[model samples]
Target chain A: MPYRFLEDVAIADVAFEAEGRTLPEVFEASALALTEVMVDLDGLSPVLSREITLTAEDLETLLFRWLAELIYLKDSACLLFCRFQIAIREGTEWELQATVWGEGIDYGKLPLKLDVKAVTYHLFVIEQIPAGWRARVVLDI
Target chain B: MEAKKIAEGIWEVPRTAKEGMLVPARIYATDKLFKEMDQGVFEQVTNVACLPGIQKYAICMPDGHWGYGFPIGGVAAMDTKTGVISPGGIGFDINCGMRLIRTNLIEAEVKPKLRDLIDRLFHAVPCGVGTKGFLKLKEDEFREIMVQGAQGIIRRGYGWPEDAERMEDAGRIPGADPAKVSPKATSRGIHQLGTLGSGNHYLEIQVVYPGNVYDADAAKAMGIDRDFQVVVMFHCGSRGFGHQVGTDYLDLFGPAMKRYGITIRDRELACAPFASPEGQDYFKAMVCAANSAFANRQMVTHRIREVFSDVFKRDARDLGLDIVYDVTHNIAKIERYQVNGEEKELLVHRKGATRSFPPGHPELAERYRATGQPVIIGGSMETGSYLLIGTAKAMEESFGSTCHGSGRTMSRTAAKKKVHGRDLLQRMEQKGIYVRAASFAGVAEEAGMAYKDISDVVEAVETLGISKKVVRLQPIGNIKG
Candidate 1:
């Protein structure tokens, strides 16, 4: 697993830390951690796909926006994803493009856990370490 | 870094406790409760005291715990002329509140049909993640509900005509401009009405035991007359709509602070001057989310009524399904308060703290003038919740506020690690609580041991004279989202 849940970070909300050797890997790891907080990934089937493209001023904001986009889609379209193919390109600004595959949420078939409300900037971190990229996020559930 | 015990159930951290602090910080808790508070509560509350235009004190209730930028039970009253409005202070769930509905039936009559009733409610009122509401509204109608709140839904035949009066602000605050809300927020929340979102959100059937009623007159005034009278209480908020509103403003306020030349210790405490354009825009938008929350609870109330009508084979009204009170614990409002012997308007931000307006206050509805506003403090499903009444002391000291709940003392991950969902289910059943949860993992995460004792939090507020204990309601059946 690329991401692990933090035991004592947020008392009422879910907090996790993710790591990867590349920006895309880290983003994918963080995305999976967030989705895992809501529902089991194994229970989801890749019958539907949605493409998202977002740009932010920095890597941290880009990660925040990416997670927020996943939450927004969950509410707006009743969609949840189990797989992510992410690409992060940093030019003048940080841009993220991803194609996430999942299916429409069926309450009867899926085991839904916590509802990830919003991604908070509290203790939010995204940076490149000497070995790889690491990101920490606290999600409002 | 030091907090001195100022009085019984009260602790104060001087302005010298932290740099850039303009006012002192006060925490309302017993010595026991205070000891359990994490270091984050002190750090965040002190950080709030340093914000520009803060007045008197930055107060944390007995249920206070570490939150994003502000403590969960944080309350800060700011000078309206110079103070700033921060989205972090109000929380992501705008107007996340509690609604308590009364019923004439007693426990004996309801015991046999409890499981059937709860199951029906579970099916009727959609819960859990990615659950859409039953009501499908056009974009315009959604906007109307944003502005009109419970009144709009009541007009649409979702509630009784008098239901609005039983709510704080009559379930609709004035000056909510739908135009201030973004399309993203609207789309995200348009289908979320009547939904009970997960994570500590629940719809429970509670009974007021004979010995639990502390103030008989107050309890009766709030419609708990019988010894074992039944009531329904649910905790939820504006859903994704409120989160989007908070998120949108947090993004804007972060940069807006730069234009205002404001610097803060924490980025999560991002704010803009209350009178500034950015602040006013957020305020109006926040009101829209607040009203949407009111409307959300209204639709949930209607669904509960429908389920009750079907299961019991009687009209909802005939079952005495009337609202006892609806109170929102999370919000920021510009209210007039006496500061320094002068009555001036202040922007009071209450995050995870209920507004405990005393009796005779002009804001309260006529029915509650004698008994004061009814304050509902929801507890963990395993523990009992409380009903308290506002007091004059709260108005004079804490800016009309009190604790919101038995705040969490343990992290969700730790809780899930300690309590297995299946075991907790069996344990709760043995304790006479029948729970239907959408996710067993969620149940483990919300185990009773993870939170502070409801009685302790209630005692602190009661001892401080902020609110008087009226009654305690025990949950008999619960539907967890």
Candidate 2:
């Protein structure tokens, strides 16, 4: 696993730390952590797909929008994803393009966990270390 | 790091505690609760005090805990002319609140049907993640709901005409401009009007035993005269729509802050001047979300009435399922308050806090004018909830605000590790509390052990005379999202 749940990071909400050797890998890991909070990935199959393209001024804002988009899709379309192919271009501006795969929720079929309300900015950070890149996220549950 | 004890249940941190603080930060809690609060709350409350145009103090209720930007159970009143409006202070779930419905049915009548009732309600009220509402609204109709709120549903025969009166702001606030709302928010919320979103949102059937009635006169006034009286309480908000609005504004405010030349310790506390175009736009959009929440709860109320009527074979009106009161815990409203003995209009932002307007306030309906606004405090599923009333002291001291719920003491992961979902269900069943949840794992996350004691949280406010207790309600059946 590329990510781990951070216990005690938030008392009422869920928090996770994701790490990868690159920006795209880190973004994918963060998305997986968020999805895992809602349902067990072992039971989820990627039967459907969605392509998301987002642009932001900075990597932090871009990460925030990326996770928030997944939450939006979950509520608006009742979809959940377990697989992602992400690409990130970083410079004065940042751009992200991802092809995500998921399936429509069947409450009886999937073992659901919690509802991720929104991606919050409290103690939200994305940083680069000598090893690679790491991101910390707190989701309002 | 130490705070000075200014009064009983009140602690103050002077402006010197932080470099940019404009006013002192005040926290209302018993000594025990103060000790239990996380260090983050102290930092966040003081961070709020540093915002420009903050008047008096940045305040936190006994239930205060670490949250994004403003601490949960936080309150701050900003100057209208000079202060700024931040979505962080109002919370992501705009108008996330509690609604109490009174019933003539007694505990005995509900006991036999408890399991059936909760199961029916669990299905009737669409809940859990990725849940869509029964109503598939058109864009124009959805926009109308953003403006009319519960009144729109009532007009469509989903609710009684009197239901609107019992809700705060009469279930609708003025200046809700649908044009201010974004298409993304509209798409996210269009189908969620009648849903009970997951995470700490629940609908419970409670019994008010005679021993629990503290203020007989006040309880009777609110229609809780019978021993073992039954009532329904549900907590929810604007669902995805409100969250998208918060996200949208927060994104916009990031740039707006730079344009206005304002800087803050945390990026989550992004804000803009109240009278600025960006600020006004977000406020108007927020009102739409608030109204959407009102309409969402109204739709749920309709379902509750239908379920009760179906189970009892009686008309809903005859069953006496009247609304006791509905109050918003997450919101920002422009209200008049006395600051330094001078009457001033201020924008009061309450995040994870309830408004407790006292007796004879012009904002309340005539029916409740003499009794003060009813304050509904929801406890954990394993414990009980409380019915209280606003106090004049709340107006004088805490901007007419009180704690929202039993604040969390343990993390979700810890709670799940400590108790199995299946075991929790059986334990609650043995205790006479039947719970029907969308997911068993979700239930474990909300175990009573994860939170502070409800009575203690209520005690702190009652001790301060911020709100007065009317009755206590023990849960018998519960439905969780």
**Candidate 2 CAPRI-style tier:** medium
Candidate 2 lDDT over residue span B214-329, tens digit each: 99999998999999999999999999999999999998999899999999998889999999999999999999999999999999999999999999999999999999999999
**Model 1 pairs in collision:** none
lDDT for residue A41 in candidate 2, whole number 0-100:
95
Q: Estimate each model's TM-score.
A: 0.99, 0.99
Candidate 1 residue B244 Cα shift, in angstroms, is 1.0
Model 1, native contacts kept: 0.79
Candidate 2 segments exceeding 4 Å error: none
DockQ of 2: 0.77
What is the TM-score (0 to 1) of candidate 1? 0.99
Every model's DockQ, to 2 decimals? Answer: 0.84, 0.77
- Candidate 1 Cα misplacement greater than 4 A, ranges: none
